[model samples]
Target: MARIKPQALLNQSKKKKGPSRISISTIVVCNLVVAVVVLSLVTTYRHWSQRSRNTLETQSQSHRFEDTNAASEQKSYDLPGYADINTSKGLITVELFKDASPEAVDRFLDLCQKDHFKGMPFHRVIKNYLVQAGHSQSSIPVEEWTSKGKLRGRLNTSPKHEAFMLGTPKTKGNNNKDFELLITTAPIPDLNDQLIVFGRVLKGEDVVQEIEEVDTDEHYQPKSQIGIISVILKREL
Candidate 1:
């Protein structure tokens, strides 16, 4: 056979087949699939991790509160009961935490059952912050003590004073004042150590908000009369 020229060989090599468009397309699709899988896995992991963290935080706050008077338990317990507070503005329902603070809950229930809180003014009204009642005196007069329920021994205080939580300010001594009630409209971490949290608002959040919006004077007393008309204790959820 006759020898081929170098230029001719080069031209033949140039004419050879390259990779097909279908193969390149296949490679691109595979890469996209792998990328999508990795992204999905990362997103799922992050979402689950966030949920776990939130649950742990909530448990820690609600269950792990250690107090000088009470011992905090990591385990769970059943809630006590519920109540309806009939205020001048509207009806407010609350969930009792007898297991958490028995003395406070019992005292509160006793007072409500006896209609002791009837016509007692919300003495301290801090707009958008808190609403306090059951003080020694107010524009509206409170009845005599029907039950002298005072806190004794291990007082299981709340870890946090979350919004809508019903609690009492600490007294001069180690125990909380019997009738110095407080209902927070916003998170009050500062009062966490100063109050004994025993219940939370179940319904009547609108009433709570309305109470928070009530006009107050220089001393935090409401301009218009806002008081607890009555309170009814029930065993409902």
Candidate 2:
């Protein structure tokens, strides 16, 4: 057997190992590109997930705030079995003494529910005395309210001097009058049994005071025309 030369032996080894298919530098570059792509995808996914979570949180907070405000409004302004009178000045809430003046209260509430008092001015306003309203026939001159019998025949009539004492039986008589209610600013003992005290102010007395302070004409009509805008009735809970 002939001895193989060194150069020939090296050539043979190179052939057996096959041709140089990939270089070290090429492998390193490919690995770096793959790593960069993976990093970019992870970063984009994280950013998108974070943005989605933030949007959901913001929407949830907004819904919660709206719900809280709605609940607050319901609790603040809605009391069952009370009358809320919307006037030009502001809201006035009154609690009717139904037990004492059942007929009178019922009549007044019925008129309110029917919107009969809307746009009716306080026909008679006496300073430091009482504020009287519910005159539906306010278009005519104040002097003609009674003489024309405008407010005389429309409401339930209770006998004059009907007793409205808490424990006493309701008085028997024709006392019901139409669209004429009084809110006394001061104590008027003489009016206790004489007039039907159907309801008293529970809130917004300041608005009533403002009404009383309005300038009035010689006939006790509000010069600026203070009127009832609307009336809402809530049942007592």
Output the number of the lDDT-best candidate.
Answer: 1
Give lDDT: candidate 1, residue 153.
Answer: 23
The sequence of per-residue lDDT tens digits that candidate 1 reaches over residues 44-116 is 9999999999999998776645442244332213223888889999999888887878877777766766677
Give all candidates' CA lDDT scores. Answer: 0.72, 0.66
lDDT of 2 at 141: 42
> Can you write out model 2's per-residue Cα lDDT over 1-237, one digit (the tens) per residue?
999999999999989999668989999999999999999999999999999999999999999999999897675444345777788999988877665666676666667667777786777776665677765432334343233244433444443322211111133453333446567665444343345566777788888888889998888878887888888887762
Tell me the TM-score of each prediction against the true structure. Answer: 0.55, 0.49
Error of 1 at 213 (Å): 0.9
Tell how far residue 94 is off in model 2, in angstroms.
0.4
